[model samples]
Target: MRPRKLILCVEANEQVLSVRKFLLETRGYRVVGCASAAEAIEYLQGALPGSIDLLMSDLQLPQMDGNELVRRAKQLLPGLPALILSNTVTGYDRAAAADAFLPKGACTPAEILDRIRILVARKRGPKKQMPTAEMMPHEMAVAG
Candidate 1:
């Protein structure tokens, strides 16, 4: 049986969507492309929880923006992997929500695909359990 492929792609531009669709299909991923954040929300509402393996979104979108989409999608699917594809990314753009950032103007298709692979690998790997300071003697002593 073919492996399950689940992805949410939100981009406003038609050309970008086409390219993204091509890239994802080439990599054997089943991509769900949406033109806006509202559309993404609608799609997610119908999909099963944990069905989306990754969310690839453009930073700028109409109605609702990419950051907001990432924020809301995470609330619905905690631990859902996200990647940002934007021409205007800033330091503040690097957040816990986005696992990887692809510079829209600078990155080639190959680079984007490679980054996707890396992010997917990270998601498939064992979950990271953060050690609380109070749970670690050394950390608690350091804090104290």
Candidate 2:
């Protein structure tokens, strides 16, 4: 059986955290929810390296911005895959150390799960065959 992946979910809003935690848990990911970068760092400090497989963070954290947070999180767990969530995804610097960007409220649960699965597998284990719908145009052409 495949082991459950761990996702460190960092969001400033308590309500958002609750929803995200529920979604991640329902999808079988062991989630560690944090309200700030400081809180997440504290959790990281208390945990072993590779304990958290992915870092999921909101772009609008009140104090430290998510980009800086991603950099810091990556520093703590080198090669940790990152997913950046935002309403205005273009506002974020996509080059800011994030592996994937999700526009908040724009994806269905299935889509989100698929994305998480791909990211986690890519970061943690051997590459799995991606769903055809997720293939980039160039990738599809190459496959054909």
Candidate 3:
């Protein structure tokens, strides 16, 4: 069996963090929840390369915002996928560093889960396949 994907979830609110952790865990993801960007950063620094599959953080965080966290995280692990959540739409533009941005209250739990699934799959990249002899010339070209 494939190993469960590890996610680093950062949010200042304990309640939000707990809910997110529960949601992710029940969905078969192994989540490491943190209450602050600093805490999350510390965890990242100690983590081995490719240990964490995704980074999901709240836009509003103590000391540093989610965008900054994503930027720093990318430096530590390039190509790391990040998702930023916010209660308001005003800061969506600022979350450009993130792979995706979701409005907390506006999006339903299902939507959140769908987005997470998409991001994680994107990080895993396209699946490899052997070009079959039956494949057309154009199809083989694309597959290769």
* Highest-scoring model, lDDT: 3
For each candidate in turn, the TM-score is 0.79, 0.80, 0.86
lDDT of 3 by residue, 66-140 (tens): 999999999998878999999978979999999999998999988897788777777776654222323443664
Better of 1 and 2 by lDDT: 2
Q: Write the per-residue lDDT of candidate 1 for residues 1-144, one digit (tens) a residue.
A: 325456789999999898899888866678999999999988877777767878999988998778788888888777788998878757335444677777787888878876776666566655442232112334535544
- Candidate 2 TM-score, C-alpha based: 0.80
Clashing residue pairs in all predictions, respectively, total: 0, 0, 0
Per-residue lDDT for 56 in model 1?
A: 94
- The lDDT for every candidate, in the order shown, is 0.76, 0.78, 0.87
> Which segments of candidate 3 are over 4 A away from where they belong?
128-144
Model 2 lowest lDDT segment of ten: 128-137
Question: TM-score: which candidate is best?
Answer: 3
What would the per-residue lDDT of candidate 2 be over residues 42-132, giving only the tens digit for each residue?
8877878778888899887877877878888788888788888888858466536788887888887677767777787677554453354
